[model samples]
Target: MKQLSLNDIQAAAARLRGKAVVTPLLSNIELNRRAEAEIYIKPENLQHIGAFKFRGAYNRLSQFSEQQRQAGAVAFSSGNHAQGVALAAKMLGMPATIVMPKDAPAVKVAGTKSLGAEIRFYDRWQESREEIAQDISEQTGKVVVPAYDDLDIMAGQGTCGLECVEQLQEMGMTAEVFLCPVGGGGLIAGLSTAVKALVPSVKVLGVEPDLFDDHLHSKKAGSRQKIEGTPESICDALLAPMPGKLTWSVNSRTVDEFLSVTDAEVEEAVRFAFRYLKLVVEPGGAVALAALLSG
Candidate 1:
């Protein structure tokens, strides 16, 4: 896999400017009181489509050539990426077809449908979304946009890190550690690269559900690890069996640590976010907070 350079990240930041929201990095007083360390929440939940996926989705779609854009785009995602791609494709006036698990969250499915993307559903454990997506691509000649593995997507996610660093500077604060939940690794890979580039002193950490901790094992084994079988955690979004090759390369170099949290911990964090933060963070989205609060 080709490595993402600082130039790529900078270009992505430029491409995403004025498109993706520059989400706030607010200190969680309750969290800080408990952790005994100054803790800030990067409320990417407020991002367009209600997740950080918009940065990468818009960045990738916007860079497509006219011909490619005209051909339209297709991708496979469980939830967040689906919504991101759907919204981005709508904004770009390109047709989108999202292959999602049949059991994907109702809100996510509704959100994607609301964005006017055609939905294709398959069994989460028994179906291969890649094959289904390829079939759709062959039939419709749509461009296959990967959820996390692509360089363009990774570069787009780097914009989030850039925003975080800027927010920290403006607040006259520095994060001792930056934690993000990892799945296919796009978000953490981009965030870690940008954070290390801009704030070398800060530690970039990737949090994962213990049931699907391929990233943790991969880092330890010095090779990519793939786990077979369905994830047994409530953090369904972190269920990718292996890290993307491009994501692994970036994360292996720039990420400071990998931490695993239990299903129970994830659930607690989700409830906490809803109860205290008044944020409806899904289980996968709450893993970072799970690590922070449980540690």
Candidate 2:
């Protein structure tokens, strides 16, 4: 698998200019006081489709050639990436079809449908989303837009890190440590690549649901780790069974450490964000903050 570079993220930043929202780095006074460190939160739950998935979606979909764009695109995601691809395809005037698990959140399903994408549901345990997407691509001639495995997708996710660094720099602050939720490791891989490149001394950490700690295990083993058993978590978006091959290649080199948080911790973080920060964070989206608070 090919590894992503800082330049890849830089180019992605350029592509996302004026397209993706530069989400704010939020700070809570009470939390800061308690933590004894300035905790700057990149509230990506405020991002388009209510997560950072839009960055990678737009970056990949926008790069499709006229023919491919016209032919359309197919993707699979539990939720956030489905909405991301759907919305991006809609904005770019391309048809989109998403393969989603039947048990995905209703709000997320409605969100994706609202963006005018065709939805296909499957039993996540009994079926392979990638195969479904590929089947659809073959039948319709639409390009398969991978949720996190593609280079462009990884690079696009990296833009979040770039924006974080820029936002911090604007505040005359430098990150001592940076944390982000990890699923297939795409976001962390991209974000770590950019954060490490721009702020070399800053530690980049990935947070995962304790039940689905493939990235964490992989980091410990110094290699890819295929998780066993049926993993369950409220953080649906962070339940990817293992890191993407492409993403792991980058993450293994760039990220400093992996942290795993329990569902209860994530719930607490979500409640805290709502009560104090006035921010609504999904279970997966709040894992990094959960780690920061509990770790």
Candidate 2 per-residue C-alpha lDDT over 112-164 given as tens digits, one digit per residue, 9 for 90 to 100 = 99999999999988999989999999999999999898999999999999988
lDDT of 2: 0.91
Please give the CA lDDT of all the candidate structures. 0.88, 0.91
Model 2 Cα shift for residue 208 (angstroms): 0.6
Residue-wise C-alpha lDDT for candidate 1, range 46-127, written one tens digit per residue: 9999888988888899988898888889999988899999999999999999999988888889999999999999987788
Error of 2 at 238 (Å): 0.5
Off by over 4 Å in 2: none
Q: In angstroms, how far off is 149's CA in candidate 2?
A: 0.8
RMSD of each: 1.3, 1.0
